[model samples]
Target: MSLFSGSLQKYGQIDILVSNAAANLSIDPIVSMSEKALDKLWEINVKASIQIVQAAAPFLSDGSSVIFVTSVAAFNPGTGFLNMYAVMKTALLGLTKALAAELAPKTRVNGIAPGFVPTRFSAFLAESAEILAEIESKILLKRLGTTDDMAAAAAFLASDDASYITGETLVIAGGAQSRL
Candidate 1:
């Protein structure tokens, strides 16, 4: 909140809002997942997103864009130990849908689901070259994603190119299956 408030105070208004902060707090089975860890995960992945949107709402107006960085896990439910992560990402989808309606005809709301990005946040999967290759093999593009790729998609969605697109989750997963 402080960072956002500081930015708002500095800029007075925001043209685009992207809620991309998330953490993999736990990977244990649901039966063994700690309550504290669960709360922390929910706080970062879901609650913080809502809070950011509310804080930025006053500055947003028509033509403004709000993009939530969800994940392919939201579309694919059975992602092994990422079940909880998947659930949280799915919650973002719901938030996107509802917020689109609430802020409609004004600020546009959308989401992007990037798959197997080789970022520090996904070190669990991208830490080893072998694992990265294995994951990339699953993508039709035969490669892992990059931050720039995600940024390009976001730029399009945030620009006038996607002015008519709202309440939709765009999948930038290198041709990964995203159908629910």
Candidate 2:
């Protein structure tokens, strides 16, 4: 069975949907990147979220919440290697706002832009002591973000506590200068 059907079968209704799928298929600069790599990045990081939302829209009801997981790279892509990934993530920010307007008054749509966390997806950032220290030094908290930090933000957005909030992206980057 499909995910939506199985979810509805077991839960009766969909209340909260968090679309967090993303992939960084290439590290090459945009000019040098292959079309195939660019397409894959667009497919996984941006298109997938839209497709999932389209599938889940029918089951969503009033007071339901939809959260998209974007990244700090959306605001300030620090390196050229992340240009394409950043572009896709930036698209998600626009998608969050557009979807919020599209699904207003009933289903709320928001997003979370997480900072550098030492997950397998971002292990390269912490691969060396010099690099890790340099990154931490830039953060106001002087430490890398944790999964728990991201989880807390997501939980708040998904819960009734954030009922009045919509179409906003909370940046949980420990003050890593995501924006000017």
Candidate 3:
């Protein structure tokens, strides 16, 4: 009901709605990630997205934007570590496009698929500083991502400058396996 409250409080005047919340239980092979794992991921990453969009739809004005935060793991089947996490992210990409089409010209919708940003979500990968440094070594930039990197992209997409773009995904993988 945060969605409903945000709408009610905003008084049907939302300029932008960004769904940035996510959750991940464990990172193992798909065969090992079980029903509970799948259910938890679906609840947070998928259902909540639709629920919040439904809540925010009434508040959004024409030309408003909706940005869904996803991950490069969607296309890049991350490590064996991603498991169900990667699948949910991939589903998010589809959801972004589907929602964009559903919203149409009134509201522009897009997604950002960022690489490994250093955050609590990825703390699982770096249980310790040693591991964190180890993971950083693999990135094309020779460093992991920062929250600021993602913030800038989202800010730009939601801004009036991106008025013509919709149903697209901007990847922020630090030159990690990108096509020219």
Candidate 4:
């Protein structure tokens, strides 16, 4: 928070805040996962978001937007490995809605759930071309999402183009199933 505070002081008020920090540790059955791992996931994926929004709220005013970069895992639990990550992402959905209500008529709170993006963050799932191809096949778009894709969505949400949108998450999973 100290760094956030310093940034606020240095840069002035914020127009858009994107909370995209997350750590995806080992994935296993709930019982098989260690307590420390679970705690780390909760701290980074969930608690950090709460702290960020709270810290940024004062600097954000009417028309500002807050976007959380979640994952399709929130709605579709991974075979079993991503159970912990999925749960924490799911919690962000609730936080998005609640914060939207709290900052309503002024700031907007929303989430973006991306699917099978071949970034280092997701390298664990797409370690090879064949593996990535197999995963992309499931997406209707037949391609992995790109950072540009997410950036476009975030830009729209931050602009007047999405003035009327709030308290809702935009699913950019390339037509993958993203419902709870």
User: How far is each candidate from the true structure, as Cα RMSD in Å?
Assistant: 1.7, 1.4, 2.5, 1.6
- Compose the digit string of candidate 3's lDDT tens values, residues 1-180: 555665466575788888987998877677777888889899998888888899888777899999999888878665657757777888888898998899999999998988878787787676788777765676778877788999999999999899999999899878765322
Best by TM-score: 2
After TM-score superposition, the amount by which residue 12's alpha carbon in candidate 1 deviates from its true location, in angstroms, is 3.1
Show the lowest summed lDDT stretch of 10 residues, model 2.
1-10
Please give each candidate's TM-score: 0.93, 0.95, 0.88, 0.93
Stretches off by above 4 angstroms in model 3 are 5-12, 128-134, 178-180
For model 2, the stretches where C-alpha displacement exceeds 4 angstroms are none
Clashing pairs in 2: none
**Best candidate according to lDDT:** 2
Q: How many steric clashes does model 3 contain? A: 0
Any residue pairs clashing in model 1, and if so which?
A: none
Model 4 per-residue lDDT tens digits across residues 1-180: 554678777888889999997898877787788999999999999999999888888889679999998888898765557888998899999999999999998799999988877788887777777777777777998878999999999999888999999999899989987898
**What does candidate 2's lDDT look like per residue over 1-180, in tens digits?**
455998688877789899989899788988899999999999999999999999999889789999999999898764657899998999999999999999998999999999889998988767889878887888999889999999999999999999999999999999987862
Query: Which lDDT values do the candidates have, in the order given?
Result: 0.89, 0.90, 0.82, 0.87
Q: How many backbone clashes are present in model 4?
A: 0
Sequence-dependent TM-score of model 1: 0.93
